[model samples]
Target: MSRRRQLHMFDNTTESELHEQTFTDAVPTSQRYLHRRGETYYFKRKIPTDVPHAFGSKGETHWQSLKTNSLQEALRRLPAEIEAFDSKVRKARESRRQGKVPVASRPRTEGTTKYLQEAHIPSIIERFEYSLLQTDMEERRVMEDDAELDIRLADFEQGLKLKKRAAAREEFSHVEDVAQVLLEDERLIAPPGSAARTLLLRELMRADIQTLQKQCDALRGNLFALPPTVPVAPRDLPTMQTAFEAWRQSQDKDRTIDAYGRYVRQFESENRELPMASISLETANKFRDYLHGCDLDRESIINCVGGLATLWDFYERKSNRITSNPFREVQYDGLPRRESSVDRRRFEVSELAILFNSPVYLGQHKLKGQVKESAYWAPLLGPFVGARIEEIAQLRIADILRINGVWCIRIENLEHDQRTKNMGSHRLVPMHKEVIQCGFLSYVAKQKLAGQTHVFPSQRNTNKYRLWSNALTKWFGSYMNRIGLEDPRLVYHSFRFTFKRQCTVCGISDEVRDALTGHWLSRNSSNVYTSDADRQYPFPAVARGIKKLRYDELDLRHLHVADPFDQVDRAWKY
Candidate 1:
């Protein structure tokens, strides 16, 4: 154990009283160099000294000196000096071994705990393993029924392998005998008949494979792992989907299921060949093509795949799952998310004729499949009642009320109000007397009435109401083509538009029309200030307008106008 060496790194300056040192005044101990640097610390420069000496054993060239300092200063410096000296010695010895300096002697403190931990990590691991093996051998010296030693041995191994992030799995191999027994017990704990057993085994196998894979991935991910001269991209990019599930969780659960379905369906149908983890940009483009060609409207595309783009964001934040989200870079574009024109406000003359006729209020034909017979009545009531699908779906037996002995359905704040879209929408609408007994209500008394709630609740699956609008439109289109009455540019929503137009032509006030349509006047101004009573401020005036449209254009005779639908049936009954 030869005496350890030291280097004195100091700068020469014109101090009032100072001496020179053999080596230079080093920036040692505290990780920092003593300099008048920017906004950091107050200066702590040591007073200079003229102490020159070369202290090294034969054939070795090393700088060495001794200095007197306050006890606190020496204590602060000693640790740094020791470390720096060791580093320099190792470097110099390595250089010498390359035929440059001199062969090195090992330091006296080399056998100490700190030195051994830092310098010989492998040897420390090997020794711990040997101790465990010897302990096992000692246990073997006792009888098989030595329970205390067995517990001690199990504890020892458990202590050795406490962390999931493994350290020195090589030494772990020595604990194989106990590990095997513990593993066997774990295997038995998973009942053989249960799916949990297969799941547990698969998980265990996956954990091992993934843990090493993660380590390698992390090694590649260290920013400074590559040389400073190399070019690198910051692993995160715009296209990465991260934490979207957390976002999607905040949405309504039905919407959540719809969103998940959109993605699942896309993967199932188009990207079937691509793994979710390995889905590439080309596949996303293919998906985009598949979506565009589905004949879905622009709004549907936005609804379905907006959820998916959000899904990609969640994918981006994942580390072990997906290092890079391929969907992040994928560009998804579709048609504008607005109805082109609610302006073509015409009622298909034929459909309107049926309401004007109301001839025995006949149910035309039975609807097949997921639809009901009354489903044919939706288009029958749409414009005539000014009912939105959500309002119609939530209709119950109780919400309908008679005012002044006039039979009218009163739509109130229906149950499941959370399902409605727009504000001021849950308000009541006074149904025409004919609409109440339209057979739609008679069907409702069967759904277990609690209050004057949703009127046609059987149709209210939140989705089922609008399902028939398209089929009805197509059927009407073909019927009109056969009948030689040119098809009109109208949709289900056109019902409300026609009702509003007739109200306007009949000179009903804007407020009454809005009230009838369950709309407020000034969304910002009208909602807060105007009450429903105020909305229907002049209903008598509005009823006059309703009468004019009932009589003038529908071209019903005086008796027919009085009870339009019954006219044709009454004539024959007469």
Candidate 2:
């Protein structure tokens, strides 16, 4: 045969024969999803029409470079890639159907009657709302299914003999499958669905309930396809401060709101009266640079940016009020994190002696004008028990109780008037004998006799969020300055470190020390298990540790008064 005639015959080969030749040359026949191009594997699939519109693709086929030269690794990743593509297609189709968008063009116009008429399309916002409602309904159905499963499981656990345990196990596996399919928590592995795994799944679901709801909304809006700069506006939009108020209201405590106020204020001050919708990457960068210009450290800048991002994110994900977050993923470009420059010093033994010997301890100088029992005991207790000034200041009379035959103060968040840092901060701090010897219990009895709930009644609640934290912290700082230990960071918090050091000097175990100091227990299964349990710290161990505490070098013997009732010996006067 002539050479030209042979080439023409090869080009005219049947499609099946051509595919077979390509497969034999590049990929194994067993690997259905993997295709090889130039010795590298690629994920090749036909682009679904609906999915292509969502991604703005006009191509007939999509080829993703797996960036792997190994056939084995490509095979390993094939299933996940296919699953991801399927999910994308599904989401895109749902969005298009809900929005009634034409399959040909993906347009970006505000959802208005005029706009829709001109564009010949459904209102995108209206579509999103409808999609949200539909998703809400679907989520309710899934939640109902999960709830029914929970009820059945609870009945099984409670010894109700209606159904077999095997049925329950089967139901659990089914529910897990449904979750894996719907929720797409591919990272979770619940094989055969043991009780521990069930517990873990339940915890994960609880934590991600809001997030899952937000994802459903985002999918409905086709948010993944939207550009980062595109502003998403809901029908009813709130002002910047109004949005911030809504965000703050959703928080667990008012303290978080108060802490975030500084960032909000900074944004408003730097940028003149800008609306929440007006905030963009440019504005956010300006604010970051402003913070850096003010000589704020990297963490502070991170916190400011992070706080704003969190606020904006809450609105976007929770309320669906906005589309973009300017502060999200913002980087601190050239700013280096300065080592904490605060010159905090632990109270020296001599300094404690000097303070205790001064009128503040000796009852020679009486506390004046809203200065309460905290001034007296907090200073004295600082050297002994090593508690935060605010913790001591906010203590109720009931907190000081005898637990396990030892007098201790319970630092808890039970009272409406108190707040704790974390679970670790809520603990039983054993009251030193020196505290009782200095008429502390006598003062509590007096306050109780007067029908006072707070251990210190003289200090007013200047700020509602923090129970005299600002005022008392300032007072303590001034008192320290007066006594001549005037380091800026050596204010009230230094006592905590001093106490920690003293505990170390006394050879306290780390677990015991953490219990006393309100530090999280060892970062291990023990800590996680303990946190999950009803009781936080091991009480018996904590009690033993507390009993082991002794400030031997600390001598406040002169400060101790003989009579609890004597006017000359009244520590409350100071």
List the pairs of residues colliding in candidate 2: none
Q: Write the per-residue lDDT of candidate 1 for residues 444-524, one digit (tens) a residue.
A: 443333332334333324353333233444554554444343535554556777777777776767776776665754343
State the lDDT at 303 in candidate 2.
80
For candidate 2, the C-alpha RMSD (Å) to the true structure equals 26.5
**Decoy 1 TM-score against native:** 0.37
State the lDDT of candidate 2 residue by residue for 196-287, as single tens digits: 35543443333233333444444344232223332233222343555577787766666677667656665664553354655678878888
Cα RMSD, each candidate? 31.1, 26.5
Give per-model TM-scores: 0.37, 0.53
lDDT of 2 at 472: 75
lDDT of each: 0.42, 0.60
